[model samples]
Target chain A: MIERPHHVPERLGLLSGAAADPFLTEDLLRGVQGHGGVDLAKVVEPLPEDDARWAVEPLRDLVDDAMFQFKENRTDADGWLAPRLHATLRLTRREAADKRIWNHIALAVAPDYVAWRHLPTASEGKVPRINPVRFMGAPDRQCFSRLWWAAEMFRNGADYTPVVRACSNQDLIHNSLRVSLVDHRPTAQALVRILERGTATTGREINGLITAINTAGATVIYDAFAEDEPRDPWALRQWITDAESAPPVPRHVLPTGPDEEPVREDSVAKLTEYFADLFETAPVRGRTP
Target chain B: MKFYPYKRLNRPIALRVMSATLKLPDGTFDPLDTSAYSVPQRTVALGVAQHEDWISARIGLSATLPPGATDADAPWSGLRVLAVLTDGDTNLRTTVELRQDAPDSKEWSGQIEVLRDDHAGRASLAAYAVATVDGVEGRSITETDADWTVDVVSEEPLGGLRLDVKQAGFSKSAREWLRPYADVPWVIDTSGRLPLVMINTDVEGFSDLLGGNGGGIENKIHELLLSQMATDVWTAVFHSAVGDLEVEPDGSPVFPTDWRGEVLREMLPDVAPGLHVEEALRRVHRRRTDDTGWVELQTRIHYAAVRRAGASKAVANALRALQQMNREDSE
Candidate 1:
C-alpha cells in the first residue's frame, strides 16, 4: 500500500506523459507497490495558486478511502470514486481537456488506485502489464479521464444518480461515453433510464443498442425532436466556486452536481421509450425474435 | 500521447424506422413490425421510392409492393410499399433516415436507428451524421462516411434496383488523398511512395478507430494491412512514412526503395516488375469484419475506385466483404 504524501500541493499542475514515465515502475504495474506523492509532485507545473479547485487532499482522500472500502474488489471502486472526484475537482471542460491534470491525478495522487483498478486479471500473459496508455491516454480511455468524463457526460445536471447507474455497467460506459451523442443531457439520461428499466440488461444488449442509436442519429435530427434548455453558465460558475467550502460528496448516497435544471423529463421519456423499442429490434448476434 | 479510444462520435439522432418486407415470389410487400414511427398524413408511404436491394436468403425487415402497384404510378400515392436498395448489409435492407437537420445539437430524438448496420437506403443510408448532410448522411451504403449517388428511378418497381456508386474516382477520401498528388507534374514515379502515403493515412485512421476497442477481426485485418504494406514491396509503397516520400516525374511517388523483391516474387513474380503493386492490391479483397472501421475503409476505396475498384487491393477486400455478406445472408 502507498501512503498519502505529507506535503500535498496547494494547487494542481501539468504533468506531461513524458514527465509521467519516471514514476511508473515494475512493482507499480503489478499492483505490488505504490509511491508517495512527494517525489512525483516535484515534476508538476502548478496551476494558479488561488483557484480553490486546485486543492489536492480532498481528491487524495477520496481515492484512499475508495481503496480501503473496496479492498477485496478494487474495480467496484469506480462507481464510488467517479462522482466524488468530479465534484471534488470542479472545472469546466476547458480545464479538464488538459491532459496534465489527469496525468498528475493518476501518477502523483493515486498511482496505486490506477493500478488497483486496472491491473491484469490473469497472472499469466506475455507480460502482466497495465497499458501505459491508461496512465496518459485520451480523456475517455485514461484511468482518471474516463471516470471524470463519465461523470460529466452521464450526470444529470445536479443529479449524480445517473452517473452511478451509468458507471455500474462497464459496457454501458464503453459504448456510449466517447460518442458525441452521450454529451446531450437527454441522451445520457435516456440511456440510464433504459438501463434502469432493464431493457438493455447485458453488455451485448448495450453494445447493440448503442450501435443502433449511433446509426439512427445520422438521419433523424434528435435536437429538433427533443429540445433542451440552454445551459446556464452561471450555474456552472457558482458550482465551481462552491467547491471552495463545499461539504465532501457523501459516499453512502449519490451527490448532486451543479444546481442547474435537470434535463427535460418529456425529452428523456421520449428518447427512452424510443431507445427501448430500438433495443428490441436491434441486431444482437445470437438473439431470436 | 496515444489518442483516447472512441467510436466515431456520431450525432445522436432520434429515429423511427418505418420498414416492412417484400415477398418476391408473391410480389407482395408485407410490412415488418417497425417501431412506432408514424408516416406523415400526406402519404401512406411516400410516392418517392428512395432506395431498394435484394438478397435470396435472410430473415428480418422485408420490403413490400403495395397491392396492385404499377410502374405507371409515378410517386405512387397511398403506396407505403417500397424496397430499400442498398446499405442494407447483404440482407433485406430498409433504411430509415430521419431528418438529421439539427445543426446546433448533436443529440437527436424521434426514431432511434439501431443495428448500426445491415440496413439500406438509396442515395444515403441512415446514420447519425452532421456538418455535411450530403457528405456524411447522404454518402455510402453502410454505416460509414462514404457518399453514394443513386438514380432512384421512380419507375423501378419496389424501388429495388441498386447501382454501385459511380466507380472510385468520385470517392470522397480518394478525392482528399488524390487532390494534392494530382496537381503536381510528378509522373512516371514507380518508387512505391504514393501507396505508402495512402497506407499511412489509413493506418493513422485505423489507429484512431480501432485502437481502443477490444480485439476483433478488424484489428487482425488492420495488422495484416500494416504488415503487408510494410513488408511487401508492391504494397510497401502504400505504407511508407509520409514524411520521407517525394513525387516522381510520372506522378508515381518515390520512397526509399526498401521494396521486398522476394515477397513480390512469391506473390506474382511473373507479372512485369512495376505492375506488381497493382496486382498485389487487386488481390487484397474485403473480408467482411462488420466493423465500423472496415465499412469506413471499403467505402473510401470503392469511391476512389483506385485504378478500377475491380482491381484495387482495397476492392479485393470488398470481394471478401461480399463473401461475408453471403455467409450472413445464408446463415
Candidate 2:
C-alpha cells in the first residue's frame, strides 16, 4: 500500500493539466514510493471555504476499499468503485463537468488509485504508462469522472441497481459514453433493460445496439411516443438544499438519489421494446449475417 | 383558493350540462346528447340587456332601493352594466359594455373587470354567463378570439386570478407547485385550464426531447429552462413560477453559468417548424402534471468530516511503531 500525502488539502481544488505533470512519476504510476503531493498541493486552487462539498477523505476511503477488495483483478475495481464513488460523491452534473476537480482527485488526492486501476503493462515492445489524460481527460475518458457519469446516466430514478449492470460491461461505458445518444433517460434505461433481459449479452451486440439507436435518434422523435412527464423543480431544490445535513452514503448498499421521479415505466418498456427490434437488425461484427 | 383557470364563461358552449345530477332549480334539466351541445337556462344564466332597462327592471323595482330615489342615484348606465353575482362571501362585480357599433347585436365587447373573483366565480357562472335577453345561454369566450381580453381591475388583497386547478377538478400535487401569473389577464373558466408557465418551459423532459444523458438531472433542467426563459420571458416564467428554478441575485441560473450561450443557440433556431401553432401549443399543454426542479444537493459531508482520514496510513503506522518502542523500553 502507498502512503497518502501528509498534507492533502481539506477541500478539492483545480489541478490543471500543466500542474498535474510533475506528479505522474514512474513510482507513482507503479503505486510505489512517491513524494510530490506537498509540492503539487501548492498549484491547485482551493474551492470556496464555506462549502464543505469538496472533501477528499470519503473518496480516499472508497478507493482504498476498492483497491483492497479488487487487488487480484484490478479491472474489476470499476464495478465496485463506480457506484460507490457516485454514491459517495453525491455531485450534481455541473459539479462533475468541471475537469479541474477530477484532476485534483486523480493527481492530488488519490493518484495511486488512478495508477492502480489504469497502470499499463510494461510489455517488451512498448513503454509502460498511465496517461496524463486519464487524470485530466473528458468526462468519459477520465478515471473517476467516467465512473461518476456512467452511474449518473445509468441509474434509474433513485436506484443504482441499473448502474451496477451498466458498469458490469466495460464496453457499455467505453462505447456508449462517447456517443451523445445515451443521454435520453428512457433510451439509457432501455439499453440497460435490454441488457438485463438478455437481449444483448456480448460486447459486440451492445455495440451494435448503440450504433443503431444513435443513428435512429437523429430522425425519430422518441419523446412523442414514449413520453416522460414534467418533473417538479421544487423537489430538486429541496434535495439540493438538503445536502448540508445528509449523512454519509452507506458503503454496503446503494444510496438513493434526488427524489426526482424515475422515467415512466411504460416509456422505458416502449423504448426497450423498440431498441430490442433495432438491435436485431443492427450489424454486429464477426457474426454470420 | 388558488387562481382557478377555466374555459371562458361566455364563449359559445358546445358541451352542455350533462347528467341527471345537473337539473335546474325549477326542476328542468337540459342534457346535451353525444355532441354535448346546448345553452344554459335563463334562471341559472346571465342575460345581456340594456344597462338602463336591466337596472330599472331588476334593481329599480327592487325593495332594496331607497324611498323616492331616482335611477340617477345608481352608478350604472347604458354604457356599462354590472354582472351582479354573489356566491355570498365572494362578490364578483364584473362591469362590461357592448361594442358601441354593435349595441343591437347584443355582443358585450371590451375588458372583463373582476371586481371580485371569490367563491362567487362559480362553475355555473362559467357555463351560464352571457345569455340572451330571454336569458338564453351563450358561447364560451375561447382563447381562439385574439381580441378578447379580461382586464383584472385589481386582484390585490385577494391576489391575482389563478388556475385553481384543484377547485376546477384537475389532478393536483399535494401542495401548489406554481405561482399565479397575475399580470397576464386570463379568462375565468369552469374547464380546468393549465398554467402557461408549464408549457413555455422546454424543460418538459420528453424523451424525444432528448437531454444530455450524462448531465445531472438538475443541471440539465436548469440549463434548458433558464435559456427558455431568456429566449422568451413570458413563455419561460412557468419554469420560474414552478418554484424550483434558482437564479442568482441577477436572475441567472445558479448552476451551469454558461447556460445562456448554449440555450440561446438551440432556441435561436426554428427547431420544430412543421407543427401548427395550435398543435405546437397543445403539445406543450400540461394538465394536472407535477413538476420537479425537485433536485437536492446531497452533501457528501463524510469527506470534510473525515478531514484527517486522508493522512498517510504510513505516517500513522510509523507513529504507532514509535509509541510501541517507547512503551517497550519502559517495560
- Per-model TM-score, in order, reads 0.50, 0.47
Candidate 1 per-residue lDDT, tens place, B101-172, comes to 243332233331222122222222333232222232222111223222221222222221112211122123
Q: Which 10 residues in a row give candidate 1 chain A its minimum summed lDDT?
A: A218-227
Q: Worst 10-residue stretch by lDDT in candidate 1 chain B?
A: B161-170
Model 2 per-residue lDDT tens digits across residues B1-331: 1121322222332221221112232434333122211222211211222111111011110011121111333222222211222121111112222232242332333222222112222211221122111221221122111111111121211212233311211112111112132222121221111122233122234322333444334434434433332233322323222222222222332221122212222221222235543332222222112252122111211221122222244335545666776788899
Candidate 2 lDDT over A170-204, as tens digits, reads 87877676654555567778888898999998998
Candidate 1 ranges with C-alpha deviation above 4 Å = A1-10, A35-39, A122-124, B1-331
Error of 1 at A226 (Å): 1.6
Q: Which regions of candidate 2 are displaced past 4 Å?
A: A1-3, A25-33, A122-124, B1-331
